[model samples]
Target chain A: MKKILTIAALALSFMFLTACDSMDSPSPLDTRASDTSGELNPDGLPGDATMGADSGLQDRGLNSINGFDPENINPEDIVYTIYFGFDQYAVGSSERDKVKSAADFFAQNPDMKIVLVGHTDWYGTEEYNMLLSDKRCRAVSDYMGNIGTDPSRIEIIARGEAGATMDVAKNSPEAKKDRRVDIVKVK
Target chain B: MIRRVFLGLFAGIICTSALFAEDAGTIRKDAGRLNVPIYRVAITSSDADTANLAKRAFGTHGSFRLSAPSQAQFIFDFAPSGGNSVKLTIKGGTVYEQVFSGSNSVEALMKACDAAVMKTIRTPGYFAGKIVFSYSKNGGQTSEICTSDMVFRNVRALTRDGNDSLMPHFSPDGSKIIYTGYYRTGFMDLLLIDLNTNTRKVFAAYKGSNTGGSFSPDGTRVATILTSTGNAEVWTASANGGGFKRITNTSATESTPSFSPDGRTLIFAGDYRGAPQIYTAPATGGKPSVVRTNISGYCSEPVWNKVNPDLIAFTIAQGKGFQIAVYNFRTKQTKVVSRGASTSGPKWLNDGRHIICTKSNGANRQLYIIDTETDSQKPLHTTSFGSAKEPDFAYTAR
Candidate 1:
């Protein structure tokens, strides 16, 4: 998560035309400031030291990757699961009320964290469905983000056709019912 | 794995040195006509289970016609040895007879059969590989990650019941597994199960979805789908599950990042060009280039062939269902190799010629081994344990 890896040297490149990588050496990339502590300093580096302009670290984390507390504290389920449209991640206008419900839940329980477990119908490949489900989670998260929900308190999981019935037709309402995100409240 | 296979040539067991001298008689004369080879082989085993399973494995390849010892070119005789080992004696084969041991007799027999494959067919035998998949009972959301031999022998539960554990991938050596499990926090977080220690820990508890965790070839780094950054993107972490680094920077959803056998490039699926297409990016941060499979508009879950890195196996959307297709980089053409009610989630066995995938017919989702070279598909195991999907095979040499 915003990890600044030091390119201690520039010569070592992964050139072992083999299927195995020994856990040896200084571990080519992502040295993580000091250790694998998962701790970030204010500068998002090990300490407050300003990163060198030629560090080439910004290219690594152009998209910020951050860690979250995985504690499952007194989790509760929100009845309204954010249903995504067929092969779509955008939260429908009708689903806005469900997002409001989540917003209201977070507002009522200020110390709670929201877990958006994503899903998809039996429409495409498993991996593609995973991404589609993930975008659904993000859509709901972004909507709640507009409601001022802290991203840190939200954990999104893309389940991707995990719960869908295989025998049913692809477009059946039972199958489409699976293409949604289940909301859970955690501490 | 080809690297290991080459290295295996020098350090290979004394019995398997005849790789180049494999008998050509077993290969059909007109092979490339349909990518199928029908070899006449005979299996002699005192154990019915061993013979039946071996025949199943052979038939699953859509090759090998059962024949008498006198008529067969490759003959295999299996006998239980002192321990959990199988003593395989070949009468009509090139390789010398040897003993293959495993945790049990079935595994031992598979090891022997796989060895026999290398000796006669000149290819890796994945029958001895370990398979990990999520098993859902009666099509429920709650599932468990289970491990078994290729034929579903010695099934062991890694995760518990009443929790969703999906897409478990095997590390190169078959000693560790990384999967997206919600058994812990009720939210999908990547979990690593050390098969040796029988312990599991959170590999990626990132802010967003952490799914599709697969190990890099050499078993050093793990490629996973972490959505924390922007959208779903391919990210790499150390084998110890630390020092995370993002590989592909894309706003389009990215899933299933697989390292080339050389571990230099990554082949993954992204919707950047509208529909899902296979794309390759440098293992290090770089721009991603599209892999024009052209077989279909939707191709996802791309995995590099371990034995033959140039070959790629992915799920391609067919007329109404999806099937496994192999795209040969050299020919720049794709071949659809599987025919199922709905087959997807294909992972290559040690043998580049064969693949392990899931075939769903009605409510029955079962693991199957498909011979891409012959377009032969056969069930690896039964649905007695429930439906299985997303199988990852870790082939360890015997």
Candidate 2:
């Protein structure tokens, strides 16, 4: 009886020790990593681009959207398409030149309006990918806003993981081309 | 003459003893039912289409084992009733006859099979349901909403936007389909397709990502994901696409808000606790509590069982791929249900015992019907249908 009791106690202790060791304090915070994919620069602030931070959207020279169609814009009319990392929406410093290039094109064509369409690689769930695409779009629009463009002029759309490039290896560098945002003129 | 009479009497005595020996507990003491793993059934139909449909229906279920008529405990005999219906006479376990109707032969035969299951097994049979899924062609460049019977026949596109459409789900009544499409605006908007009216309209186009539209059990409300706040949050609207209200007030990007069978609760995938996990909230919107699946940190795409309220199915990360897992609310334990080739996107069949999901094949994927009870996968399509994903099922009586 004593031996049996001892064995049972040992078994219970081992189970307690081994049970849920994986649940320790946010096991593998891929959630945080994915959430922070929309990280902003210097402090990831202004992350809440709610309706493009809509407290003063109309006050900030909001453009009227009546007969604008992004499909009508030619490939050459597009200033620059922003590219992002895997599951990321952050406009990194490397893409600053591209954002500036779009902003410069805007300066050249003040009468025209530009549209931002966001997309992602087909790696995550469909619904989340849809939101992530929007996050990337809002991030670029916010970037354009920071660089002196009418936030209203930048009509944003999210294509999610649509049109994912599959002609090359998925893990290869060329796949980054799939996670991009197009900057088309919507005049 | 006396010897002949004695021999006849002996034969009669021998026959009487043989009959007595075959009585219960008198012979074959080990002939018990302790070894049977599945129900043995025999399916026979004069019509080739009916027989083929019945075979497909019974062959894919794990609870049933198709066998010869002599060895089966149940026998299903089907007869053509009309152009697209069948009259099934089930003989064994319980004897009954039922007339099943559908829009096509496969659908009708499936309904008859489901009737037999209900009459014999006393559990839900989901073979006669319809599935709405998004099929992507041109290498995932553009997708269109499509619907088909459970057998993957009767396939037709609901939307030919020529741009992109995805995450198609059926209303409770199976008369409408709700999905997100890049219709004209180049932005993803919640679009509704009423099968009865053959008309399409925008359900929700609230200035940002509007997707993940699902119907409540009563079909009076819709649960969706809205990004007007710059983050994906659970929101509900009226059945007519009015009375918008946000359900979750958090920075954690939420997706896929599924209502419980009782229509009193909502389960969704969110990163509230720093990672993606299953969480539940009141249908009227309150503090959300995480469901401790404890299976993985990357659990998402949760769909609540419509028949069994205690069950919720989701996708869990497996190595570099993903697999389907089920969580029981009563036991609070989670178990993996499906395997192989980056399978994800689980939606419950009406029986609550099956799920319609997708399995990846490199860049393209295909739809599969999974028997959660046995982890058996039956591909809905043998031929390629491009990349089919995000499947939702609706069960309606014809």
The backbone clash count of each candidate, in order, is: 5, 2
lDDT of 1: 0.72
For residues A93-135, write the lDDT of model 1, one tens digit per residue. 9899988887887888988767777788877877688778889
* Local error of candidate 2 at residue B141 (angstroms): 3.6
> How many clashing residue pairs, candidate 1?
5
Clashing pairs in 1: A1-A65, A19-B217, A19-B218, A20-B218, A21-B218
The global C-alpha lDDT for each of the candidates, from Candidate 1 onward, is 0.72, 0.74
TM-score of chain B of each: 0.89, 0.87
- Per-residue lDDT tens digits for candidate 1, residues B264-344, read 888999888777889999998799999998889889999999778779999988977889999989889798888857899
What ranges in model 1 sit over 4 Å off? Answer: A1-81, A97-115, A147-157, A182-187, B1-37, B68-71, B93-96, B138-140
* Each model's fraction of native contacts: 0.21, 0.22
Q: What lDDT is obtained when candidate 2 is compared to the true structure?
A: 0.74
Point out the worst 10-residue segment of candidate 2 chain B by lDDT. Answer: B24-33
* TM agreement with the true structure for every prediction: 0.78, 0.79
Candidate 2: pairs in clash = A31-B275, A163-B141
lDDT score, residue B278, model 2?
91
